[model samples]
Target chain A: MNRLFKKYEGKLPLKVINDIKEKLPKKISEAKLKKILEEVVMEYNKMLVQPGESVGLVSAESIGEPGTQMTLNTFHFAGVAEMNITMGLPRIIEILDGKKTIETPMTEIYLKKPYSQGKNIKKLALSIKETKLNEIVSEFMVNIAESKIELRVDEKRMESIGVNYPVIQKCIKASFKELALSKKGDSIILKLSEKEKELNQLFKVKEKIKEVYIQGIKGITQVLPIKKGSEFLIITAGTNLKKVLELDFVDKTRTISNNIFEIASVLGIEAARQAIINEVFKVIQNQGLNVDIRHLMLVADTMCATGTIKGVTRYGVVKEKASVLARASFETPIKHIFNASLIGEVDHLNSVVENVMLNQPVPVGTGLPGLVTKVKREPEWLKNKH
Target chain B: MKNINVKKHMLVPEHSKLTKKEIQELLEEYNLSLNELPKIVSTDPAIERFNVKLGDVIKIIRDSPTAGKSIYYRVVING
Candidate 1:
């Protein structure tokens, strides 16, 4: 075992080597171990990417080809009303484009310890779901003659959301200091403070009151606690990654938001890179497409290689290309050319795009292998004699 | 200074950058030029924590399901 381990020391990681050591039988002969190690080494060799493979192009084609066949539709979450995930091709485009604000920003929040083991999950979900004052109000009557607005809060809805009238009153008072908020049993009355009582001003205040935040975490519109195996995880419709991770009961290590830019700023570029790969793979898999994960990983790495999330668009990764011609090849060729000339930028013609654009042999595959042959020449006198 | 340990959060692969001598040895082993090798930006978060310079090579060790562990190399270039 030691000899086998030493043979593939640097070739494999220490953890894998230890695992192999543990799995080997104590009575196995040296020859048998040698054969097993050889097979393992061969398998390892097969997994490596070949030199000059043009992985970027391969990855693009692999994803793009399958993308054309994907249906453009949003998938509704199981048993969750009005919570539809932007899936299929549109979702893939959103991810690769690195849009700052996605149509449906969501997160899968895992709880820590007892919370994950199906304890107080409903309460936890209620606490995370965002509740605005407007959502719980059954009626909003604008009394223009009295210069006031009467908001009748839904008692049952408020109870279900676990928010009391006092909390709502406090939030309204803090948000709108200019307006006086008075609670009358289950309803809250809003009127202009002694300063101004114009009809227009009261109308504006009435509109603003409807949008005031009441309780619960902001940006999380809904949360559904679903049981998976022995643990329970919450799926939120809207994502506020920073705020969610701050909760003591949340499993910071496992909780993930689908917003790549948010992840990049909050967790760092590596996490964003991983999130991109996972999200892209998830979208493709949801559509029942079979694509190698390595291709997705390459795309993710390229997008986040510069320590920020950049889309595949001309404004993003394409614009960062070293070769001016390569940049021109991606999109907006005339604009790229015009800008490159103005700056006197040089095109090294090193990459595949520029070479292909110029109709020259691309620097990949067989083109990478070149030969330099020296021509043998006879002296001038010997040539004349011949 | 607070160290942002990226590995603690997710399954980040092990990244070890190769020195000049080791890079030279890798080139000889692979029988390829520096340009032929796969490129990773110098600012890539996986290797940014290390004191790596331009033209350095990085060795990435990832745990794969098919293969127990797969080793890959990338040449570090400026972003």
Candidate 2:
């Protein structure tokens, strides 16, 4: 039986063979197994991508057609109130265009082992959230005559977020080297220098002091701990994939950021390719659209083909085309033509667009092959006799 | 402790460096040169542990939702 299986291994994928083995009856005959394996190979071959199929065009239409029906609704309430994610058409555009700065960047961070089981889950979530000075301050008392701005520390709020007085003191000291701070009971008084003691300067220092970064990961503005299945995880508003992945408790393998460039830089281009597929598929699934996963995979592959994420926009994948005319036809026709002529670039008409521009049959589908036939017209004498 | 096995991730597929013989067979099977194949940077975290060099072909075995499983090949290139 083992030898029989070995014989068919080269003909079928290992997963398919393993699946068949698991599902087969113990009492099945060798001949029946052979027949089953043969049939599986036949079915697999029948379902494969055919030659001359315009897959890129098909995938484009499959995803693009559903895009028209998608609502322009930008903000999606992500169960956590006030954390709105960009979704629908605008988001699809943002992702496909490969915009560097996304409208709403976020991350879903999975914790390691026992931490994922709600062991100090709240504390962990709080620690991951960036605590601004304003969030932990109760009131700002400005001493007009003394050139001092006093910040009353909200002790209860600080304790809840696990931030101590010393941490706050350190944060302030690091941020404002010029301002001399003196600890006075629950309030920390900051005294500006005599030269910079104008009312306007005092107010500016007061406003700037409010935004001091106190603790937690820098970019993560807010973190919400929610139970996903049996495990507890965090969904953060702002994304800092590199820093978050470095934390001791974070499950680096599972944690993912919605920012494609971040993923590309942190995890590598392949992961970014997978991210593109998952993100696009998520939007399509949420919108009740049915596009084959292969289509999305093809798009992802194209975007990541050059070992970096490039959008379908003119500056990205379009700019990398081999044919000069294809690049010229996409956008800025005159500019592309001028540059091509200046460089003495040539258009080989290899792609569909260039051939179309020249009023020739596009080299795809039936036009892919060249047919050579000898026209057996009778010789001139024979034709005249007929 | 900071060392995370990248292949263990759900999104990451099984990545293995192909032998010279295997690479030659793959090239012949696809009728493509090394450059015609898709590329992965030599520093890609997924294949970092493999200690792959430039021009080495890496085979990726992915779990596909539509096709159940799919295989992809990428040549390692300098970033």
- DockQ score of each predicted structure, in the order shown: 0.25, 0.50
- What tier of docking accuracy does candidate 1 attain? acceptable
Cα-based TM-score, every candidate: 0.80, 0.90
Q: Which digits, one per residue and each the tens of the lDDT, describe model 1 over residues A281-336?
A: 88888889999998887888788765578898888888778998888777779998
Task: Please compute and give the TM-score of the first chain of candidate 2 against the native first chain.
Answer: 0.90
RMSD of each: 4.9, 4.4
Global lDDT of model 2: 0.88
Give the per-residue Cα lDDT of candidate 2 at A291: 85
Residue pairs in candidate 2 whose N, alpha carbon or C atoms collide under 3 angstroms: none
List, residue by residue over B12-69, the lDDT tens digit for candidate 2.
7788899999999999997999999988989887788889889999998777776566
Top of the candidates by DockQ: 2
Where model 2 places Cα greater than 4 Å from the true spot, the runs are A193-201, A372-386, B1-4
| Quality class of the docking in candidate 2, CAPRI style | medium
Best prediction by TM-score: 2
